[model samples]
Target: MADLSIDFVGIKSPNPFWLASAPPTDKAYNVERAFEAGWGGVVWKTLGEDPAAVNVSSRYSAIYDSYGEVSGFNNIELITDRSLEVNLREIEAVKKSWPDRALVVSLMVPCEEQAWKTIVKEVEKTGADGLELNFGCPHGMPERGMGAAVGQVPEYVEQVARWCKMYCKMPVIVKLTPNITDIRFPARAAKRGGADAVSLINTINSITGIDLDNMVARPIVDGKSTHGGYCGPAVKPIALSMTSEIARDPETMGLPISGIGGISNWRDAAEFISLGAGCVQVCTAAMIYGFRIVEEMKTGLANWMDSKGFETIEDFRGLAVPNTTDWKYLNMNYKVVASIDEDKCIGCGRCYIGCEDTSHQAIDLKPQADGTNKFEIIEEECVGCNLCQITCPVDDCITMERRDVGQPYMNWTQDPRNPHREVTEESTHEA
Candidate 1:
């Protein structure tokens, strides 16, 4: 069996799958159950001065597809509603019991140095493996100047991370909010503050949907609604892009990343790790399917690793980062044409309509002996955009085939079309 263990910023976990600091890790009961179900670690839900914070009923909303599956989720919930002392005691007990699994406490506090100093000391006494500063909660905490309010400002993120790093003895991981314009700024800020690693992204501020009948946003409480944090499968692309950005950024390169958002399966976990995430955190998937999902995640990842001849997670981790680059760095000379298998085409006309009306008119309609229209791609007109492949209902029926263009490597910067090019005799000869 391939070894699934990982040492993320010196915090070792049996695997890279940790429960995010959300309802799943809110208390010892859930954490204990999650550990039993094969999760490698848990970041205890964000804790603060608890007497002032309280949660409301009807705290969740979701967007469902035609099949009634949840594609996206929204939550108006706040952090740990239990008292500070109670949460600490539970965390201490859980850490004592689950000695092998990683237990990191998540904390949010008032924007004062002393407030952060006090909480860091209290959490350190719990013998937790590390601490995750919950600067990314997008909902209620911001109203009190705690969550996204602090996260949105790079200086505030840096200052608070510095405070935690100064006061806390354990490894500090700064959780970042995606609600900002440029994620790199905060990522760089966290690095400046001496954070051991960074976890992202918290949730996107969203209104899941509006109840047309009631004329209000979803998750209505007392017939009224408010914006909440949006997450789940729909956010995977956004999460992957941001993770890759930080991982590839020259300023934040080699900064360990704890990937979060829309990770529902082992494939998703592998994708995150390949894209420079040291470990991955899960919440919505567990909330939807339960902790046993970790079994599949572990098995699938281990099996895939074994097949790939990888002895450890580190071997494949960040392997894809180098391949991820800016648009300008893409191979402009490379070309691919879309190919449709006639035997597999169901004559759905989906690809034809999509290509003809919305995209390049590469697919042509042909009269068939059966009196049905057959779709074929025009080789000359096809740009290999793959819009037809994407719009096709059948899987593997349409695929992009790499064409041997036999052209030398060329890019916009070196192209003659670029008037601002720094032209030299050598460059002109190459062009």
Candidate 2:
């Protein structure tokens, strides 16, 4: 089997699968179980000092898919409700017991130099592998001038990161919020402040659903609701896009990234790695399925790696970065239209109805003498869109077959039909 181990910014883990800083890593008890269940590392839940955060009794809501499975998760929960002293002691003990597993403490405190200096010194005493600046909590913490409040300001991120690096000897990783306008700003700030790595993307701000009866948002607290941090499968696309942007950004390029968001399996982890993530983190899956799920993620990833002849994570990591490009650089002349396979077609008119009703009317339905429905694509009318392919029920029944349009490759930047086309910064990617 291929090696699953990773050395991310000097923090070595048995594998790239680490538990994200969420409810799963709140205490020593939960962490020990995760390590035993084969997780390579964990970012302990965000911690604060003196007066702790007070959380509501009902703290969670979820969005379910048509089949009734949770596609998204929302939470108004704050930082660690437990005292700082107890969390520090447990972290010390957990590190001592699980020497091989990565234990990086996640922290959020008042945006004061002395406050950060004091906590950095104290957390270092526990012998943790590193520290993750909790600048991404989108809910309660922001109101106190922490979390997203600090993250939204690039200056604060750099300042606090520099403070930690000055006081603490361990590696510093900045956790960035997704609520900001552009992620690269804070990422570049972390780099300027000398952070060892960057982890993303913290949960997005969202309200999962509404309670019709109570006239409030879902996860109602006393017949009331407020927006919370959203995660789980639904946020995967957004997370992937953000991670790619940071990995490919000129200023922050080559900075180590720990990918988090909607990663439920080995395939999701692989995608993140291919996009230049040094490691991957999980929370929603563990919350929904328990710790044992790591067994499958570990074995599945290694097995796939072996089949692909990859000896280690580095063999395939960042393989997709170069191919990921801006829309203006895409090949405008490339063409592929849907092709219906008679062998695989189940006589389902889903594609026909979908395209005729909402998309280009490019498919024809014919009734065969054998008492079966035949759906065929109209070659002339097909505009090469994949709407029919998307609505098909059976896999491979509707395939997008490429055609030789006999046209030289041309991108949007050089196309004659573009009304506002010009050679500019975005066009520089064309070559």
lDDT of each: 0.92, 0.93
- Estimate the TM-score for candidate 2: 0.97
Instruction: After superposing candidate 2 on the true structure, give the runs of residues whose Cα lies further than 4 Å from its correct spot.
Output: 423-431
Error of 2 at 275 (Å): 0.5
Q: List the residue pairs that clash in candidate 2.
A: none
The 10-residue segment of model 1 with minimum total lDDT is 422-431
**In candidate 2, what are the lDDT values of residues 306-363, reduced to their tens digit?**
9999999999999889888888889888898889999999987999999899988999
| Global Cα lDDT for candidate 1 | 0.92
Please, what are the lDDT tens digits per residue for candidate 1 over residues 1-431? 99999899889899999999999998888999999999999999999985848888899999987899888999999988899999999999998898889999999999999999999999999999999998898888899999999989999989988999999779999999999999999999999999999999999999999999989998999998899999999999999999999999999999999999999999999999999999999999999999999999999999999999999999999999988877654667779988999999999999999888988899899988989988888988998898999888899999999888898876655677778866454443322
